[model samples]
Target: MSKIKDTSVNFENKKNLEETCAEIYAVNLISGQWILSICYYLKQGKLRFTELKNKIPNITERMLTLQLKKMEEDKLVSRTAYAEVPLRVEYELTPIGKGLLPILAQLEQWGKLHKSMSEGSAT
Candidate 1:
């Protein structure tokens, strides 16, 4: 067997890195309906709040506001505020958020496969 690192500092750093990654992943993107749906739409293109609301009709304004705020905090989404006559705002995925698309796609595919398998087994 290979020898392991004997330094406590090294071990603590490794643990901290893993914990940070886990925390980042567990920032609750999909916990709220509006957030996941918002990301789904943003993967296509940027959208205004009203457009997003139209896409997700069941989400409350308060919930959408809260989710967007959290996503912004997590750097998963960019919020652009314009200083126009009527003032317009739009939301889009940051590079970090865009990076999540492939993983999300794989998860979606797996979910479909799992559902099909479950139905087949039931039949």
Candidate 2:
């Protein structure tokens, strides 16, 4: 049979392009203001809604709820509710979310190094 040249590039397949853009997709998913922080906290262990609110003092209740809901929807977090007199809800990172810890740790290290360098230069 004669050689058939690939026409994928010429056709510009949107689905194929998106499938290859995982880095961009990841960045977009974690771009929310408190997403990184939330992931950091959850890395320690599961936490209740109020506990998360108390840990991150500056975050408003509405914002926390919204962020948690978004994270849950994205399959990055697992939410569990306990049946009791008082409603109890907890959130923990999913396996995929746990996979991001090393990346986050690297970012943390970079931030610290950058801060130190900036301070040294300022002096």
Candidate 3:
């Protein structure tokens, strides 16, 4: 995702919208191509970086690291490091992140419904 400069009009408008609407603000936090997908994978259980990468083969390692870092900063995911040979780290959803699963499920259902509706209309 591209970062909008804070001084830009678009950025200002986004800040205003987020300030006025809690839902918009929440969506903004998770508004990346990979964030939702990452969360879905994490919903299963704690996973190592490589494991998460395996689940999302299309995303670059750099992008995954950035997303994980952002999620950690946003309190959506927790990271733990183990003092083992070659070093080890695991990522898991925080309670707040777990709370998003039901919401995501609803979104999935809505997407299916919309897709079918669109296809039916096209035919």
Candidate 4:
């Protein structure tokens, strides 16, 4: 059996590396296969279940549901339900989720740069 590293550390004066690994935590939280895609779509605005499904054509309903549930649990997305003749539900990013947009954008820029460099070198 493998061992897990102790992550707890006193944070009274300064930040602890293990205890304050926000980047690691962020990466793990959004590391799901469909998470970034889902966040990209939701970043535009609120979307219903069907709308979200249509936006991500290849994702199965089950997978989308699961990802959404996990994101909701992580406080990244908000699920709202309305009572009406036809019940309605919408999902939108919470404040924390919105804060991730800049990071995602930076990642996208980095990916583009890497891809360009890779292709140029391969030539």
Q: Which order, best to worst by TM-score? A: 3, 4, 2, 1
**TM-score winner between candidates 2 and 4:** 4
List candidate 4 segments past 4 Å from native.
1-20
- lDDT for every model? 0.81, 0.87, 0.96, 0.87
Model 3, 10-93: lDDT tens digits are: 999999999999999999989888999999999999999999999999999999999999999999999999999989999999
> What lDDT is reached at residue 74 by model 1?
85
Q: Give the runs in model 2 whose Cα sits over 4 Å from its true position.
A: 1-20
Candidate 3, residue 82: Cα displacement in angstroms equals: 0.7
TM-score, prediction 2: 0.81
| Winner by lDDT | 3
Q: Return the number of clashes found in candidate 4.
A: 0
Q: What is the lDDT of residue 94 in candidate 1?
A: 96
Candidate 3, run of 10 with poorest lDDT: 28-37
Best by TM-score: 3
Off by over 4 Å in 3: none
TM of each candidate vs. truth: 0.77, 0.81, 0.96, 0.82
**Candidate 3 residue 105 C-alpha distance from true site, Å:** 0.6
